[model samples]
Target: MELITSNTHQNQIIEEDHVIKKANGNFIEANTLKVTLEHLKNECIIPVFSKDNESTISHYEFVLKTKEIVQDLFPEFSVSEPDIRTSHIIKGRIPSAIGKPAKELKEHEKTLYYERCAFVMEIPEVVENVNGNKLALTIGGVRAYNQENLFSKKSPEKFKVFIGFKNMVCTNLCISTDGLADQIRVNSLNQLSEAVEKLLGQYDRNKHLGMMEKMSRHEFTQSQFAHFIGKLRMYQFMDKTEQKQCFPISINDSQINTVVKNYYHDPNFSCSGDGSINMWRLYNLFTEANKSSYIDNNFERNVNAYDLTNNLVYSLQNQSSNWFLHN
Candidate 1:
């Protein structure tokens, strides 16, 4: 972990010339819609705190503050519009009448507010080329209903923030534990900003890039690939004790199934004509499947994908017994 100091601000900025440009593509994670910051500020209704409850930062405010901090920190980078996912729609009458049943209210009488929300932001200029694919720097946050107790007095509200790389070829975010602050408890925007900055400052971009670049050099033969897929499926049914003996896999069986399908069909990451696939391509197959994950689980699974793939690389380099790779 890198120690953050007063010079952190100056140390964080890349010394390259500023080349402002939008990210080449959009990031539409599962169940999320692309929305502008202005739309979030103007159209969404902020949740009201109960009489005994202290105030907490709103989703719009959180996104805005985080964006401002990133802009200030990386003046040369261009941020994309936020991709937001919302749920548990709260409805009320436009005129604010009391004790009206749901059936009594017409469509026009209904006002709306989302009970939970999550969003992601991409910075295009702070990017690197791994092999031939462009991986851009990305940051995001999750504000979910389960993270807070709405009826309680002033307490720290929990939020999740991550800073990582987004594969521009497929827009699949590559994250690791170092890049994620899974539980940032804060009562105010200033605290949240500090937490975000801390996570960004601690992230090791060169190390991450080196890991991905190394994956490009290792390959899995046709038979090894088949055995790997079969083992993953079988691992899903193994008893908890049995699972503990093997490396942990963060993606579910559904995602493993997707990986199997993509192994043969995915245009960019599929196996070559001789039925051999490099570890980097295999890693991406997992991330492509991860796109189906819900917003809350998305970042976790992405981090896991990197971990699992990196472990596979370790197993290959050391000739260790890896259940997924060995029979």
Candidate 2:
């Protein structure tokens, strides 16, 4: 489906503030530090393959190239400054004619490069309001040292790209399998660009949004909510044979605890005074808790949240025998 035309003048007014708010809220308690695009390009060191002179694609290059592609495809969309995360730092000291031990090298002589990076950019103009919460189109990718073999010849580098919605209120990503390219192996920038373009071109935005809208129509009573929590907690300990019969959930016990806490305490998504919660709010609770995940695991878990919640909503509407929903 074609993107809905946005109000340019009004979007410009709130764009900066919106970017700042999202940057501040995202990545709390996570294994990453936020950085600006300029900082990433100018301050970070580019890494080279250990066995060859060839350099791997830098994080800045990946993000910049993707941004260029997005701008070309959707010129009217206002892209936010990148929300960046870098970890697993590799440090070194410059070689000197007078050989010295590593401990003797001055701090100023030390150079560093991050071994992993993940980032997301939001298209604020491409937004949808579901039950009073705003979700904007977001695109991002991840690069990790573990995904590559630096000692080998110039092999296909690994990357992951995802297109989804970022909850404007909490900066929680909402993704599904349709929106994620989990294993993108490419040899060059051109190949990477093509991969990203194909993913965006094929995504069904209308169908995804329609599913989210349907979630608002399904509610969980206090009793049902309690049962769901108990069943989910038990599912983690269930045997593989038993788990295969039920809808899959990727979140861990800590995240489930967060969901139960938010069901009663979240300012915007909490259950109503009647002690009932809708699927949409419950879905957000799961996504919200996912912010604590490591950068490598975050997007995958976000997609799982959408899949799990979507199935729950289906069970609620069709009276299916989902283990979490049925008695």
lDDT of 1 at 150: 74
* lDDT for each candidate structure: 0.76, 0.79
- What's the residue-level lDDT of 234 in candidate 2? 94
Model 2 TM-score? Answer: 0.87
Per-residue alpha-carbon lDDT of candidate 2 for residues 1-327, written as tens digits (9 for 90 to 100): 111111221211223323333346773357777777887787677876777768888898899998888888899877888888887778776766136777788866777778878889989899887556678998998888777888877788888998888878778887878999988998888899999999999888888888887777777777888888999999999999999988887899998999999888876677877677777778888998888787777888888989988888777766667778666
**Alpha-carbon shift of residue 18 in model 1 (angstroms):** 28
99: Cα error in model 1, Å: 6.3
Tens-digit per-residue lDDT, 1-327, candidate 1: 111112122221212332122354434346655556676677666664565655567778988888888888888768877767665566667666557788888766667666667777888778798756778888888887555677667678888899888877777778877999987998788898999999989999899899987777666777888888888888888999999998887789888889989889876777777777778888988988987787667778888889988888887777777788765
* Candidate number with greatest lDDT: 2
Per-model TM values vs. the true structure: 0.85, 0.87
The CA lDDT at 122 in model 1 is 83
Per-candidate alpha-carbon RMSD to the true structure: 8.5, 7.2
